[model samples]
Target: MKTEKGFSIADLKMNNRLVLAPMAAISDLPFRLLCRKQGASLCYTEMINAEAVARNNKSAFRLAESHPDDQPLGLQLFGARVESMEAAAKKLAGTEKFDFFDLNMGCPDGRVLRQGAGAALLRRETRACELVKAIKEAGKPVTVKVRLNPNVLNSIRVCKALEKAGVDCITVHGRTVKQKYSGPVDFVSIKRITKAVSIPVIANGNIRSRKDVKITLEKTGAAAVMIGRGAIGNPGIFADLQGHLAIKPINAMFNYLKLFEEFGMDKFGRKKTQVIRFLTKVKKQQVIELVQKAGTEEELEQALAELK
Candidate 1:
């Protein structure tokens, strides 16, 4: 078997190129660190609202927290306005230690889109170009995550604009706002975008297993792959993609559970059960089903009882 090498967002060679996508509510410090430990070449902070960061919101502070160990971490922010987005980028560049900054143009949530943030910016190509230019001015390797265009012509146009704006790379989530997360990712469209741009393109959307990683790389010709929902609770996928299976699924489960109990509960001030439920939502059933089956509801209750 051939081994796959990794690269940081700076193009620094790494152990693997698998990136953990920034997921809202799930990609906390603990989760991202776990993925790093499990061999992810890169990881990102959860998508933060740029408005919140620009306003100096304390909640935004939590979004950028990281341990010394979590190096090569990317901080992703979402917004539309040039000044607010630029201010947020400046804030991150000022004090927050991060490997890079990512603009979230791919988020399709109605709330975000309606506000002219996230995927809404993709529709406004001129503004998206300017936003990328602002981040580039911040002296960081700027990456942009964009949704696939409802019209392919727009996809190519956005790619051209981002490249011209000097983004280091563009992560194309191969689904449009209208498509949501419905069908299979449109790798063909991603390929077209990749071909249209000079900068690196990281293909994201529905990348689940090791095989899928290789196929996505081949099909889309992206410089790398970013795993999102598929990576939740399955940190070992990072190692698995690299031809190293030193970490087991059970170990990953326990590690994720402990992390959830620690940072998750403390940060949210929620009961352990509530935290456990939220973590489980991102976790696959196969990993948690065994634990759930071994313990009765009461026994499971006892497991989390120690948490609070």
Candidate 2:
């Protein structure tokens, strides 16, 4: 599990342990392709709304789109209602786009919390387990992503219930809802979940570099590490974790632009917004302004070239 060799959970296998966490509005087709090319073993779609999918919403299915090369992907779903979650999974059961379905119980967004989903499920462990069981009825492999409980180390208890509910795997994002994404990942809590559950426990939160991957794997004893914010614009971070040469941010952005355009997803400033996520090193106001005002791939390239 520590090595980058093939890891399997309930018959789902990937060549490596590096996985791209589902980021809303960020893990689209083009972006997932970039990550897959950079060696992410599995790239999950952004959390698809179960309510929307169950309601036959085209936008939800569009968000779950994938390319031919983005194989072995996971379709992540988020919803508080078990009936909607079950219906959504049944609807997507025949799709070849995803290899498995992941339930999102760790998103701390205010809107999601208000709906009694995401990390709100972290506080409602019983309902969370029921959601897992509901999706498993669709006959595809299911996993759950969760966060630690505030003021106590109860993730192990929650994960145990999920394991009993027949979850294929579990991803533990080491921060509670209250902590959100700010504090250090609680490696101790993640380690506990890994030990408590028979299923694979993925360690997430604050994994940005090879060093972070090394330490997290060692301390948490997790089967794999999931990267979210760290991989926003730089997909090569996956390759970097394997001790290979990393693609420069500027270079990655150009490649991203090509993927962006080739996929015909260039409307409504989506391309421009993604281009900005790759500017991890650009600190100048004028260069930032140039990127902000740019309208086309060529202009974005020019703006990035300024940093060189």
lDDT of each: 0.76, 0.84
Candidate 2 residue runs with Cα over 4 Å from true position: 151-153, 282-285, 294-308
TM-score of each: 0.85, 0.92
- In candidate 2, what residue range of length 10 has the lowest lDDT sum? 279-288
Q: Indicate the residue-level lDDT of 168 in model 2.
A: 90
Off by over 4 Å in 1: 1-3, 8-12, 246-250, 257-265, 269-301, 305-308
In order of listing, the candidates' clash counts read 2, 0
User: After superposition on all CA atoms, how large is the RMSD of candidate 2?
Assistant: 2.3
lDDT of 1 at 134: 80
Error of 1 at 103 (Å): 0.3
Question: Candidate 2 has what TM-score?
Answer: 0.92
Model 1: per-residue Cα lDDT at residue 184: 85
